[model samples]
Target: MGIFDALNTSVGGLQAQSFALQNISGNIANASTVGYKGIGTSFEDLVPAAAATNRQNSAGVTAHSQATITTKGTVSRSSVSTNMAIVGDGFFNVQKPVGITDNIPVFNGVTNYTRRGDFQLNANGNLVNGAGYYLLGVTVDPKTGNPTGNVPKVLQFQNNFIPAQATTSINYAANLPTKPATVASTTATAGGLKAYGGLDPSDFSAGFNPLVIGTPAPPFTDATTSGSTVNNKQATQISGATLLSGAASTDSIITNFAAGDTITVNGTPITFVASGAVGNQLNVTDSVSTMLAKIDSITGATTASSVTNGIITLHTGTASNLTISSSNATAFAALGFASPTTQARGGGGTVGAGVVIGNDIKVFTNESISGGAVTAYDATGTPVNLQLRWAKVDSSSLGSPHVDTWNLFYQANSSATGTQTAWINAGTNFRFSASGALTSPSGSSISLPGVTVDGQSLGTQTFNFGSGGLTQYASTGGTATINNIFQNGYAAGQLQSIAVNNSGLVVGTFSNGQNLNLAAVSLSHFNGTNYLKALDGGAYAATDESGVAIAGATGTINGSALEGSNTDIADEFTKLIVTQQAYSANTKVITTANSMVQDLLNVLR
Candidate 1:
């Protein structure tokens, strides 16, 4: 080969070696960079001129492009909850705010995708990355877990409406007693008052005093018959009429001499046996005493007769006036007989006063009265009397019970104080009428507004009976899958195992007792992936030159475990040595050519 050709070849070799050295430096520098892939270099030969027009000739050394990088790398487990790494082929989808002219770049919006999984939560309670970009997915209702395509909702607080503790009231009902009646009769005798006939006789076994009429004389002898009627022996027949007119008449005997007539003479009571022997009356010795007893009996009869207008008047028909020698005048006073201050009969005519008696119903002045007039006085002394038109039965007001709907003052929080800003029923069942009222149906759940969490405000959202009805997502065959994505981020987890199904979903097992979908790692089988353009950071942006990425599983790429780095370190070192040797050989060739030319000039001289 020509010395010029050798020099050119050595220079090309030095350039290729330089390129390989650059790749090795990069690999060493980023050896610990997460998800970092290493690079490799390749070379080709340059063809020389052909001997003939169609003759083939051997090529000299030249370097080709160093465009591609080895994307294979080992993914070590991280200790962060949100740190995730893609195992197979796909990228994690993230959303970032672009300039106003940008249409919020999406995965399908001509923006690049990534596999880095570090994330955080923003002020709006949305999970985001360090760039303040939201994570993208089908928005899920936390309660329902249904796919709300493109619309995103976030969770930021907990439940706060718990019923407060309070006290309860009680009510009661019971009974009371009644009143008694009054007495009427006036013909009661003095002894009759002591007898108490309606009461059992055993009640009066205690001895009682008999009513007295007049003073008795010693040796109270019975009166005898004076005239004798003849037939064979001078028989004297004293007639009843004559006996009645004599001392027997003043004997204090019960008049009419009828059965059941109780009478007292000289403080002793003797019942008259039926008209004994047509006038067999016991004779009293003292005619004055006998006359006094008779007059006293007549006085009792007259008193009984004079009991008109509830009063009794006493009068005497005998020459000797009747006198009461007993000092028990208070007993007579109890009988309503007292000396009158007016007319003089004995000393003065006595009159009796009647007793005021009945049920004695009392009317209270402050009692609650039905249909009463209420007199009210104003501050200006204006007397206003209102008449209550309705009655209260069983303590319940029967008229239209006046009610005013007023706000209940309360404090919602330590800083907030105001009346409840809603209309509330003023009485009874607060929210229902006696008739049919709208009710929250059974098994229904209601949600209130969301509260602040971690110093960020989250708005209200709710989930109720939807078209799928009240069903538990875990039990139902719905899209509500188990997702343990916490509000913060995915915590540190080791890749316990990896799984791939026919649907191209790459599910990863974690050491933290969870199974997560690392990514829907899609695979595209091209005529060749070797021909695809290489973008840095282990990504490949699609171009029209390469057909659309065919979604597939890892097995479609004809490998289970990934390929390690294609970097040939030994070959690179050998190439470096070869390049050094060739450069030295090329310099020697240039020197030899210069020396031969010098020798030719010497020979020519």
Candidate 2:
């Protein structure tokens, strides 16, 4: 070989060794970097021309090329809820802010893809990297748990809240006890019968005439006069004709005996008798008065008696007067009077006669009373108890017939006292005012319109959380605003589970009694993932030949685990010795070529 040829060969060897050293340096630099792939060098042959019978060319050693970078890196897990790594072929998409004027782009926008999983929220409340670069993915509806679209969504805390109120109206029933009867006088009779006092002079003098004697007739001789009693000693015989004679009887005289005469008749003591014939009659003065004397002893009446000439008078207790009238002689006979001269009739008929009966008896029916008021009772006549429940709704969800949000406020029981008052403020929280006039905070207020309770719809309700902070939404076109007053009102929550799908959807579960779509992580895959350029800190960037990142997940490229570097110390040392030997051999070739050139010069000398 010519000296120049030998020199070129040695230079090629120097270049190849230098290239291998550079690759080794790179590998050592990224030995600890996550997802780091080491690089290696390759050598190619150079061609030279030689003339012969049939001219042909031969190949010789040429320069080295740093060709492929093997992606033989180890995968270690941090086990963090947010920590993620692509095991196979994909990359996590990220977007670094271009400037102050540009907002973070979404998935479809200009985004840089990486494999680094370290993520956190930035000061602007966006989930980002430590460099403040925003992530990209498909956003989802919080309530429906479904994808909205491929857009970048920021995760944040929710703060729209208010209070609720109660209800009114009540009913009842009951029974009442019956009343007893009362008694007044013991003297009151059962069937009513009374006694009369006939001895009363007032009774006799009321309307009767006085008794008198009649004139004597012929065939009768007078035996005595008013002042003298002697006669001619002749006994005059009085005949029936004298007794029957109208003129002698016209005076109604009981003349058989004179005044002050006495006789025992019908077991009663009498004093006068007629004087003309054998059938002489007696005239009893005030005969009814005498009968009244006997009745007075049996009843509660007072009696008195007086005598004048041939007449005796009697008086009774003050009531009405009794009179004996001549027209009532027949009635006198009905009273067991034998002679008109013995008994007399009265005008007032009788004294102290009618009756009186039954006293003090109860008269109406019973009625029911309850709850300090009157109300209709049940079939068994018992008072009934009542119960009530009150709840609020989301105004927007009301017209939809499906209740998305509801909060219960008050419930009525038997221990409840008075009227339940519900305060519905236009832009404040709900307040419940009880019968005792006490007010208290209630449950969460619903912002949705057209909410209903027990099938009754409420158009919309206004409520407030704190001072001057209000939420007003109607079933119509009302706007709901949650102010800073309620910003501090948050229900407690915690991280539960995490899940990811091929679409790069990230769902986080919470211990706050809810399952929420917390966030969606960015993801991408390259057509030539093997050719992707690795940067520091376990990250990768796309290049022209990496072929426009077709976004995908880990398993898409196949379930192949990335094996760690085969850069064993022994193997690298042996390779280093081999490269040094080749370098030394190339230098020897140059030395030998110089020696040959020296020999040629000696020959020319």
Candidate 3:
């Protein structure tokens, strides 16, 4: 009975060793498999019951497969963009198709988890691994890039045109030079940069006003007749009292007016008569005071009409531009004016007209610096180049109340000609303090309403410059230094391709060069991974021993890469040698037990 017991125990030891060998063989076979978790054998010893605890005999040994689920595998780079790899302890949620229905894979509604991430887009645009399991993920809102729901499902992407989105706001940032090097700058060279066709500071109303910054006043003409002194009289005594008739000895006469000479004030004529003239008519013998009154009455001048020391001065008085011409050049010369003179009133500037025509292009170029340019999209997804320029209006160097002020402009038409609207003012005076910080614009954004570029209207949009995005620092180049400028809109484009990103999100690259988030790859974890039911192709199923799959996992996914098998060939081979030796040793024990049984049989005979 003891020999029989030993024989049975040796047979059990052989069976256990065979089980261990089987596990070692499987590990060696799957050494090159992707995302394979190696299995090891755990031996358990069986003890036979005896009368006394100290007299217990060894029954046999049993082997159980041990799961190496927590062990990580080596990750290597792959050429496929959609391929993903897990670097930690989580598995990708996937599903296997039960059958094909109408050429589509029908899911069995059972969720499975796997680490084999050799996924590629199938015919139906679903992500499937080599083992035919479809990948599952949560949908994401393309605009917000946020997950739509917490539940993970099979993801399918279609190659359809996305609707066009109009631009609402632009994320912009840039710096402005304190001393802008404009064409009208005083430091400009004369050889190639002459002021002839360049913008002059006088083109701007605020820049030309003497009261605002002093000096550089408008051209005022006060003509004197060659010499101010007349008829050998004292210099201060000569004025409107000077006579036009050269024959009068007591009257102050410089240049004599003839009887047929005519002077025109704003196209209204005043004729010289031999004698007894009235109503837009001046007598040859009339005094300078009489002629002045007739001229003022014809021109409707309320102010700036005077004669000082034989000099005639006239002003348009803010009502209209003054145009004075004369049929008789000599008579106009005597009147202390050029033959044809036109002078615009104060407060008139082309830059304030909100539209810069082709005739004013040279002036605009000379006054403004290139701000930047960006291609923006409209509601129809029409792309337009939004070109901008900055014109420095006021400077802090001009003292208090005159900080560094600038006006923004955009090109309305590229080919605009004379009197055609080419540029439009943004209508806000951006002011900066002496410390180069924005002072007037209290917020981070500004409105550009009805922004039309080159005949295309982009409607209204906001330029969002985050806090401290704009600065007015000193630069040696004296140009606007653009730090950053971008828009939130894009043209309608077809879905070109999709790829998994490092953030575990599936991004779709459109034909219009925009990459948008489409879905978030979901990872699942289990408390008892080793207790999971092993499925085909490195997949696992939930069981009573293994807890339910949790949604959030600490593992990270890598794009364009894959995880290798965790099985080591060298280690498996070493275990194989040990298993062979144990199996042979068990067989020897069985043979010795058989020999002992033979000897006992011989004694009984």
Please provide TM-scores, in order, for all candidate models, with all chains considered together: 0.32, 0.39, 0.81
lDDT of 2 by residue, 1-605 (tens): 55767677677777777777676666666555444455666778776765674654433464443423334345544534444555565666776654553443344345666554555544444555544446566666554557676654344322311112111111211111111011211222332110110011112122221111111111111111011111211123222111211232332222223334443322334333333212222334324333334433322235343222323333323332222222233333333222323222223332311100011001000000011211211223222222111112111222344222212222112222222212111222232221211122343333323323223333342322333222222322111122222111113345445544333446555553444564566457766765666554445567887778775555331112222333445555666777778778877877887888899889977
Global lDDT of each candidate: 0.31, 0.37, 0.78
Each prediction's Cα RMSD? 30.8, 33.4, 6.3
Candidate 1 wrong stretches, greater than 4 Å:
52-58, 65-71, 93-108, 114-141, 144-146, 150-538, 551-605
Q: How does model 1 fare in lDDT?
A: 0.31
Q: Least accurate stretch of 10 residues (summed lDDT) in model 2?
A: 360-369
Put the candidates in TM-score order, highest first: 3, 2, 1
The parts of candidate 2 lying over 4 Å away from their true place are 49-72, 98-109, 125-134, 151-515, 533-544, 554-577
Which of the numbered candidates is closest to the native, going by highest TM-score?
3
Off by over 4 Å in 3: 186-243, 248-342, 346-359, 415-420
Cα displacement (angstroms), candidate 3, residue 168, comes to 1.7
Q: What's the TM for model 3?
A: 0.81
Weakest 10 consecutive residues, lDDT, candidate 1?
A: 173-182
Kindly list the per-residue Cα lDDT of model 1 for residues 1-605, writing each as its tens digit. Answer: 45456556655666665666666666556555444445556667677777786875544565544533224455544443444444565543444544433433333343333333443434443445443434443322222234444432221211211111111110111110000010211222323211211111111111210001121111111111111121121122222322221232332222122333323323334333334322212232212223224434643423221222223333442222333221232322322333211111221111211100111111100111112222222223232332211100111011234111111111112221122111111111111112212122232322324322222222231212222222211212211122111111122345454443333333445554445544333233333334445444434454566554444324322112222333445655665566567656656665776676677679977
